[model samples]
Target: MTYDILIIGGGINGCAIAREASLLGLKVMLVERDDLAGHTSSASTKLIHGGLRYLEYYDFKLVAEALRERERLVKAAPHIIRPMQFVLPHENAVRPWWMVRIGLYLYDFLGGKMSLPRSRGLRKSDTLYAAPLKHGGSGFVYSDAFVDDSRLTVLNAIDAADNGADVAVGVAVESARREGGIWRATLSDWRTVEARAIVNAAGPWVHQMLGSLGVNASSNVRLVKGSHIVVPKLFEGSHSYILQQPDRRIVFAIPYQGDFTEIGTTDVPVDAPEDARIDDDEIAYLCEAVNRHFTTQITTADVTSTWSGVRPLYDDGASEAKAVTRDYVLELDANGPALLSIFGGKITTARHLAEEAMEKLAPSMGFRAHPVSRARVFPGGAIADFDTFHAQVVATWPFLGEARSLRMAHAYGQMLAEMLGGITDEAALGPNLGGGVTEVEARWLHDREWARTADDVLKRRSKVGLHLSAAETAAFEARWNAMFPREPSYA
Candidate 1:
C-alpha cells in the first residue's frame, strides 16, 4: 500500500515530522540510514533554551520561537527536560555591562509569558554563583533547560509509532523516481515502496538525497562542525557557566552526569558531514575558554570523552559559520509528486519546523493537517511532576536504589514500570552486564526502542558506555551481539 508521506532522515527534525504527520491522521513512514539520532542529533550540547547568544546576532525572532517551544516541551516532557540555572560572569567580557544587561532584558521581554523565571543580576562576590570564579565582578543569572537530546529524538519516533507511523531505522533509500504522480522508491532492504509525498529531512545528507533523486536545490548547505569535550567535574555547583571568549564567541561549562563536566563547542567550518571529529586544537580551545572563568584549570589530560557533529546550516551568505541563521527553510517541489527538502534548523525549533512542514505539504497531500496540540505529551511523558514521579519509581522498585531509580525515572519516565515488567526484586532485573546494563533493560531497548547494536544501547539509548572501563565495555559489546544478530543494511 502506498503511504501518504515518506520522510527521510531520523534526526530530531525528521522524527519530529514523522510524529506530527502521523498524529495528523496520515499514513506516515520514516526511513533512517542509521539509528535514530545516530549523528548530529545525539552530539548536541543538550540544552533546550532560547539562544541568548543569538541576541547579539539580532535573531530575536528565532530566540522567541525557541523560548515558546521551550515552555511547551517542559510542560509536555518534564522528565527528560528540566530547567537549569546559568551564571554569566562579566569579567573582561567583550560586551559592555549595559549592553549585556539590555540584551538580557530584551531576551526576557521577548520570552513574553514564558513560565521560566526572568534573568537577574548577580555580583561576582555572591557566593551562590561566584565561588568558583577566577575573577571578581558582576554578571547575571538566567534560566534555561537541559535535555537528553538523543532520547528526545527517540521519544518523537516512539510517539509516531504509537500513533500508527512506521519508523524504520538503519534503512536507506537506494533510489527513487516520480511515476504516475506517485513516488516509487527502493530502500536498502531491497523493497519497493510507494508514497504520494516525500519529505527530505536527511540533515547533512539532505542535498545528497536530493541529488540522487535527480533533483537540484536552489540553495546550498553550509556544513559547520561543532565539537564538545567531557572532563572531571570543574565545580561543585549544579548551575552552568556561560564563558565569553576573547573572540566574542561563547562557551558553556555544564555539570554533566554525576562525575563529569561537559564543555564545548567550537564553530569550525568543515566540508563534509563525515569530517565531524574533535581535534586536539579544538580541545585546547575549549579548555582555554573555560579556564578563563574557572579557578580550576584543566588540559587535554583531564579530558575523558569527546563528541563532534556537523550542523547543516543554510547558506545565508553569512561570512562566518557562527553567524549562520538557525532558522529553517522548507522547499516543496510539486511539479510531479510532492517533494519537500528541509534546510538549516536546530533541535530547539524542530517541533515547530515540523508543523510548518506539514502546512507546506498540505495542498500536495490533498488535505490539510489539523494537527494536535503542539504541547501533546510524548510517549512515557504523562507524569505531572517529575520529582514526585521519581519518588514513586523508587518506591515501586526498591531494588534499584536511589541513584539507579532516579536515573531510570528520568530515562523512561512512566514507562519504567513497563520496562521492569512488574518485577519487584533485584534478581528479576537480571545481571549488571556493565555499568548498570541489565539483561532486562537491554532487552526492552532492543525489542521496543529499535536498538540495533550495542553502540545504540550503550551510547545513544543510554550513556552507560561513558561509565565503563575499556575491558568491561568490550565484554558488554560481546554480550549484546550474542543477544541480537546484526541485520544486513545496504551502504
Candidate 2:
C-alpha cells in the first residue's frame, strides 16, 4: 500500500518527523533496519541543553532555538526529560571568569521564560559542588536538562504509531525508483511499498540513501566520532560538573544511574559511520580528562561502561571535528517526488526539526502545513511536574520501595499505573530480571515498546544492564528469548 510519507531511518529525527506527519493527518510509515535509536540517537551525552559551548562559535541562533526546545521537552515529558543544573568551574588559565559569567548570562537570557532556575555564580570554597574541583576560583551554575535518550526516541515512535503511523523495525529499504510519479521503495524482503514523499532522516547513512535513489546531492556529511565512559560516582550532588580541558574543549562529569558518574565525549574523525567503537587511547583520554578536574581519580580499570557514536554533521569546511556545526540542515528536492534529507541535528532540537521538515513536505504530500498537536506529552509522559507525579506514584503504590518506585516513575511516568495495575508487590510482577527489572516490565517493553533483545530492555529502554550481574544478565537473556522465540535476533 502507498503511504503519504515514508520515513527512512528510526533515529530520533525520523521518528520525530513520523510523529509530526502522522499527527498532521498524513499517512506515514517509518521503517528501520534495526531497533529505534539503535545508533547515534542512543549515544548522546543525554543532555537537553542549548550547547553552551557553542557560544564561542558564534552560534547564537542555534543555541536560542535549542534552549526553547529544551523547555518544551522538559514540560512535554517530565518523566524522561527533567531539569538539571551544570556546575562550570572557572580556571585561572583557561577562559576568564568574566567570560564564563557572561556566557551563562547570555544562556539564561536566550532561554526566555523557563521552568528551571536561572544561572548563578558560586564561590569556590563555599559549596560542596566546588569542593571536587582543583582550586576552584569561582564557578557558575546553569540550567540544562537530562534525558533517557533512547527512550525519548522510542516514545516518539510510539506516539507516531498511536497517531496511525506504521512503524516497522528490523526492516530496510533496499532500493527506491520513481515510477508513474510515485516513489516505489523495495524492502530487503523483496517487497515494494510506494509513497508520495521519502524523508531521508537516516543519520549517518543519509548520503548513502540518497545515492540509492540516484539523486546526486552536494551536501557532504562529515562523520565525527564521539565516545563516553561511565565510572564510579565522583560528586555527591544531583548537579553535574562541566570541566574545562587544557585543549579548550570541555568534558562533562555528570551524576549518572544513581551510583555512577558519566564522563565523556571525545570528538574524532572516522572514515565510516560504523567506526564508533572507543579505542584504548579514547578511553585513556576520557579518564585523564576526568582526573584533571576531580579529586576522585579514575583509571581505565575503574570504567564500568563505554559507548561511542558517529555524529553525521554537515560538512561546513571546519578545520577540526569538534568545530563542525550542531545545527541541522534540511535539503528538500522538488524535482520528482519530494525528498527531504536531514543532516547535523542534536536530540534537543529534533522536534523542531521535524516540524520544519513536515512543513517542507506538506505542500507535496497534500497535507496540512501545521502539526495537529505539538505540545502533546509522549507515551507514559503525561505528568505535569516530575516531583508531584513521583509523589503520587509512591502514594498509590505504597508497596513499592522508594528507589524502585522512583525508577518506575522515571521509566514509565503515568503509564506505570497501567504497567502495575491488577498486580501487587514484586511477586506478582514475576521473576526479578536482575536489578529492579521484573518480568512484567520486560513483557510491557516487548509488547508495547518494541523491545526485541535483552540489550534493548537492559541497556536502551532502561539502564538495568549496569546493575545486573553477568550470571543475571545471561539468565535475563534466556528468559527474554523464551518469551519471544519467534522474534529475530538482532545481534
Candidate 3:
C-alpha cells in the first residue's frame, strides 16, 4: 500500500499527528508495536494542565503554550477533561507567597481569554480549602484540568481513523529505506508500504529509531523516570493538593477513581525507558511529601498501585534531573524523503506538538497543511455543556444506572449515544464482565479502539482493573483470552 505519510507510534503524539495529517488531507497510516498508550503515555499523573513548576525554570513559552492548550483541550473534550481546582498550602511552602501569586497572575494572563475561574488566595480558616491540610495556614487555589489520559489518546486515534487514517496497533515497522523519492517500509506482518514522509513519535524509543531512519542527529535524549503511587482516599474534598517538598520538588495528591488518592512524581534519572519501576527512595519521598502537606499520612504499605513512566526528555545538560526541560524538540531530516522525530513532550501540548510536526513536514511531504487557531473537538467531544450532557445521558439511558451512565458520559461523551442508542434493555448491553464493563463494551473496544488484549481493555481502555478483585480479574482475563487468544495454536 502507498500512503502520503506513515506515522510510527500509537501514543498521544503519534495519534495526534495522524489526526492532524489526515485532517490536512493526507493518506496517513500509524503503526504501534503494542497497544495504544502501552507505555509512557498511559502512565501519566492523569492531568491536563500547564506545568506550574516549570514557571521557575523561566520556560515561559512552554508554560503559556501548555496553559493555552490545556484550556483548549478542556473545552474540546469536556467529557474526558474537566476543570480541576488545585490548592497549594502556604505553610512550609517551597516558594514565597508573593512569588506564587506573581506566577499565577502570569499564568492566567498567558492563557489569554480564559473560560475557567482565575486563581485566588484562600484563608486558612476557610475549612473548605483547609480541612485536609496538616497546617492551619492559608493557601492559593488555581484552576487546571484532569484527563482520562489513555482515553484521550484513543479518541484521537479513533478520530484519525474516522478521518481516513489507518491506525495499526500491535504492529511495528520492522525496517524502512528511502528509495525512488519515497520511503518503503516493511511491517512486522511482512507488508511493504510506501509513504512520502515518516514521523517517529515512538515516545521513549524515538532516539533508537533515528539511526534506522538514516538520520545521524546530534540531539540527546535524557530519560527521566517519573513514578506515581495510588493509595486509599487521603482527603475528603474533590480539589487536589499541590504539595511542595523541602528539596524544591512538588508532588500532587489528587482524588482518583472515586475511592483513592493518586500522588506522584519524582524526577529520577534513568539510562533506559523499558520496565521503569519506582525505588524505595522515590516512594519515601512521595510519602513524606504527602505526610508534610495533608493531615492524613501514608506509608509505602498503603500504596494500592504504582506506575512509573519514563520521560524521554531532550537533553539540555542540566545539573539536576528535576531541572530538565518538559518542552519537546522536533527534528526533521529532509535529506531524502522526510523523516521527523519528536522528543520530550508533555501531555498538555500533544495537539500543538502534532500541529507543529505536520507544519514542519508538510512541505517535504507535498502537502499544504491547514493551521488552526484553536483545535477542533475529537469524535465524541462535541458537547455544549458537559454536566447537561451527562444529565441527558443519564436520562436517555436510565437502564445503565446513574453511576455507570456518569462514567460512560465522561469517557465516551456524545459517543455514548452511538454505543447505546438502540438498546433499550440493560441486558442487551451484554453480559457483565466486571467493574461495570460488559461484553458489548469489550467488543466495541476491540472493533473500534483496537483493544487486542485484556490489559488493553481493562488497563488502558478503562481503569476497571483497579476496581476488580484478584479472582474477578482472573475470570475476566480468562474470558477475554478465550475470545481473542494470542496465537490460535491449532486454530
Cα deviation of 478, candidate 3, in Å: 1.1
> At residue 190, what lDDT does model 1 achieve?
84
Arranged by lDDT with the best first, the candidates are: 1, 2, 3
lDDT of 1 by residue, 1-491 (tens): 58999999999999999999988999999999899999999999999989999998899899999999999998888889989999999996999999989999998998899888899899535686788888754789899999999999999999999899998888998999999889999998888899999999999998999999999998789999999999998888788999999999999999988899999888999988999999889999999998888889998999999999999998899999889988889999998999999999998899999999989999877887665758698778899889899988878888898877888889899888678866979998887777777899989898888899989988899888888889999999998988887867674
Error of 3 at 208 (Å): 1.0
Q: What lDDT, from 0 to 1, does candidate 1 have?
A: 0.90
- Please give, for residues 228-319, the per-residue lDDT of candidate 2 as tens digits: 99998987989898888888899999889999999989999999998989999999988988888777788899999999999999999999
User: lDDT, candidate 3, residue 390?
Assistant: 85
Per-residue lDDT of 149 in model 1: 94
Give the best candidate by TM-score.
Answer: 1
| TM agreement with the true structure for every prediction | 0.98, 0.96, 0.97
By summed lDDT, which 10 consecutive residues of candidate 3 come out lowest?
482-491
Q: Which has the better lDDT: candidate 2, or candidate 3?
A: 2
Residue-level lDDT of model 3, residues 1-491, one tens digit each, is 99989999999999999888888878999999888988999989999988888989999999899988988898799888889999988878778889999999988888888888899998646687788787765878899999999999999899889989998877888889999789999988778999998899988888788876667877788899999999999878788988888889989889998899999988998988784898888898899888887788889999988889998898988889999999999998889888889988988999999889988987876677667526698878999998899889878878888878888888888888777768888889888878888877888888899998888988888887888889999998888877777842210
| Candidate lDDT (C-alpha), each | 0.90, 0.88, 0.87
Q: After superposition, how far is residue 177 of candidate 2 from its true place, in Å?
A: 1.0
